[model samples]
Target: MKVLHVITGLGVGGAEQQLRLLLRHLPARCEVVTLTHPGPVADGLRADGVPVVHLGMTGNRDLSALPRLTRLVRAGRYDLVHTHLYRACLYGRLAARLAGVRAVVATEHSLGETQTEGRPLTAGVRALYLAGERLGSTTVAVSPTVAARLRRWGVPASRIEVVPNGIDLARFRFDPVRRHRTRRRLGLPDDAFVVGGIGRLVPGKRFDVLVRALARLPGDCRLLLVGGGPDEHVLRREARRAGVADRVLLTGERPGLPDGSPGPDLPSLACAMDVLASPSPEEAFGLAAVEGLASGLPVLYAACPALEDLPPHTAPAARRVPCGDEEFGRALAEVRAAGPGPRTAPEAARHYCITRSAARLMDVYATALARQSLSPAPQGVSSA
Candidate 1:
């Protein structure tokens, strides 16, 4: 089937990266439309031979792009239009309906209990999101906790589908040789105790807490902050203020490989470290934590509903801790004292492979198509 994916932007965030990975495994004839900021991910998709159209949406209030998007949808003759992120969900649903496409689906990849994207969920935002949600056939939630949150926000339980975010396990598998190589490339000492955190440098991620925790640890410990965002300067200032700037290493956003590979060898970075820490209190799905587990490292996270929802056998190496510097430091000490524990990385990541996620998504697509076949199109509908 012909499918078109609509997203807010193609920046190097969780949702954007997940979409790039999903396209690698999906069988449908797929194309992409980015509303704005067609960044590195866009280049990677094009290198992989996927057509990407950039709609130069000046801002959120640029309604003129609606007709342009609708025209593109009609011209493409797509059987399905799937939307990701907030702005795309809002405009893509409307555009798909205008183009007379009946099979439209959206994925909610970044919603938490109290925040949408590091901001409080105001009433106006909820109303707008709910209005957009009504135009789609189904909404895919990335986790059970997010599904529950959608229901609480007034979305019908029947309309929500829980599909966990997946990782390419082969790319993240543990390799001692690669681990040593990565450590040397990053200029890290062989015997240093490294604690790594991966995510956009946003306020909600709480990287400052991690910096403070590093200060509270012993002299040989260090912090590695991966990914970049608006708060990079703020985090650097925080590290300096905490007197741990010397121990904190920040690698600003790394580009994907030029060959359009599925991953950036994140597992190599994870393997180079002794432990992984995720202190974000508003995670929809802890992708980094899962990758760390798959890399055979103990993970300490503050809030990961996805990990908690899974069976104990799935990720036995993940431990939950309170959200504070002292608690995080204490947990780190305990984990270091206990050593690496068991080698459950491969088993823990078995359930979250990208191939499995792609099959489940195809199932969702088939279900939507079947439901559409049973319903009659409304009369007097016109393409915009």
Candidate 2:
């Protein structure tokens, strides 16, 4: 089948990376469209031979791109249009309908109960989201937590499918050689007890909490905050205020691979660290935590919807702690004392491999296509 994937931006984030990985395993002929900034991921996708189109949408008010996007969809003659993130879902769904595409699907990568990407949910945003959601055949929720949130937001339960985010296991496998090499490259002391947190430096990620926890730990312990964002100054101030500025290491935003590519080398980074800490109070799937586990590092998280949903036997080496500095400090101490929990980290990762996730997604796509075939063509949009 021919499929077109649409996203708000082609940045090195979870959803964008997931799409890049999913296309590798999916049997369908796939292409991509970025409604805004076609960042590094766009280059990586092109390097992988996937055609990517940048719609050059200047801002949220740019409705002029709708006709252009609809034309592209019609010309591609795609069997399905799959949307990811917020802006793409909103516009892609409408464009697909305008192109007379019967099967349109979306993946919800970052939605939570209290806020979305650290912003409060306003009534205007809710109405806009629901309006766009109505144009799609189904929405793929990355975790049970996201699925529940969609339902609470008035999306019919039947239209929501829970497909956990996945990783490429081979790329994330633990390696002693890589560990030493990465640590050396980062200039980390060979004997230091490193605690790492990976994600955008957003308020909701709670990197401040991790900094606080680091201050409470011994001098031998250090914190590595990965990824880049506008909150860098704020977090730096946080580290200084906590009196652990020296112990806090901000790597800015490292490329996913050493080749200057987009994505995350979380596996290698995880190997360099003794433990991984995800103190984010809200997360859809906690991809970083899962990757840390896959890399054979014990993970301490404030919230992990994906890990919590996993069967006990298949769960990774993760411990959920209350969201606070003291609680996280204590949890870190406990984890350091116990050492890396069972060697089941890799085993847990296998259950959420990209290959398995792609297969499940194919099933969802097939079901949506079949349903669309049976129903009369949707009205209000003419075929191009």
Candidate 3:
């Protein structure tokens, strides 16, 4: 079947990672198309022999691209168009309908109302999002929290499905030797403790809070902030202001793709941390937290509903910290003093493997097709 996957961007974020994993494992007969910030992920898809169309979309309201996207979908005769993130969900699904696609599916990657600093949507925008998604043949959420949130916001229950995100076990598998080498290469002292975090350097990620909390810890403790985004400079300044600049390492952007290498080796990165810190006040599904757990490290995640129901291995392996600096510091110290359990990478991989998650997604896709065949299209729905 021809399946087109749409996303807001190919940036280093949870939704991108989820789409990457799905594309990698999708059946060979399936075809994929991407429309968003077609950067690294697009390159990676081509590397895997998957065809990707960028569309040069500058923002969500790129009406000019609509005709192009509609034409492409119609020409491809795609059986399904599965969209990830808000922008693609809005634009891609609409375009898919215009092209006479039988199925349009969307995965809600974040809570609809939650705003990450400077990016909160007004009530009007949120309403528009809800209205657009109503056109989707199926709506998916990466976690139950996200699914429930959409329902609460008035998304039709009949169209919503909850599907958790998945990771690649082989890529994220633990490697003791690689971890040792990576630590040595970074010049980390054998005796020093590393508290690591991986996420977009955004205001909502609260990396500044992690930096401040590190100041409260013993001097022997250091911080590693991985990934990149617009807020990198803002976060760097905050670290300097908090007097922990030297202790914080921003690894910038790394080379790896949904089809490229799995962003520097997980073992090497995981070895640099005694504990993984997540200070974000909101998370739809904590991929970083799960990755930390897969690496056999304890995670200190913010006390938020999105993170509270981490998969089996993760729930036991992570501790939750309140958003305040003092609470974060206390949570960090407590997790640090107590070591991680005997969970190995292989053990943790079972809960979030991309292969496992893909199978579940396939079931969702097939179910949508079956339901569509049996039911009439909602009244007043127009392909135009």
Q: Show model 2 residue runs off by greater than 4 Å.
A: 256-262, 340-346, 377-379
Clashing pairs in 1: none
Index of the highest-lDDT prediction: 1
Worst 10 residues of 2 by lDDT: 253-262
- Relative to the true structure, how large is the alpha-carbon lDDT of every model? 0.86, 0.85, 0.74
Residue-wise C-alpha lDDT for candidate 3, range 63-141, written one tens digit per residue: 8877888888888877788887777777888888778775888887776346522358678867888888877788888
Query: Residue by residue across 61-124, what tens digits does model 2's lDDT show?
Result: 8999899999999999999999998888988999998898979999999998877656577998
* Selected candidate, larger lDDT, 2 vs 3: 2
CA lDDT of 181 in candidate 2?
A: 96
Order the candidates by lDDT, highest first.
Answer: 1, 2, 3
Q: Which has the greatest TM-score? A: 1
Clashing pairs in model 3, backbone N/Cα/C closer than 3 A: 167-354
What lDDT does model 3 reach?
0.74
Which lDDT tens digits does candidate 1 get at residues 298-367? Answer: 8899888768888877777788888899999898888777765554475657778889889999999998
Better of 1 and 3 by TM-score: 1
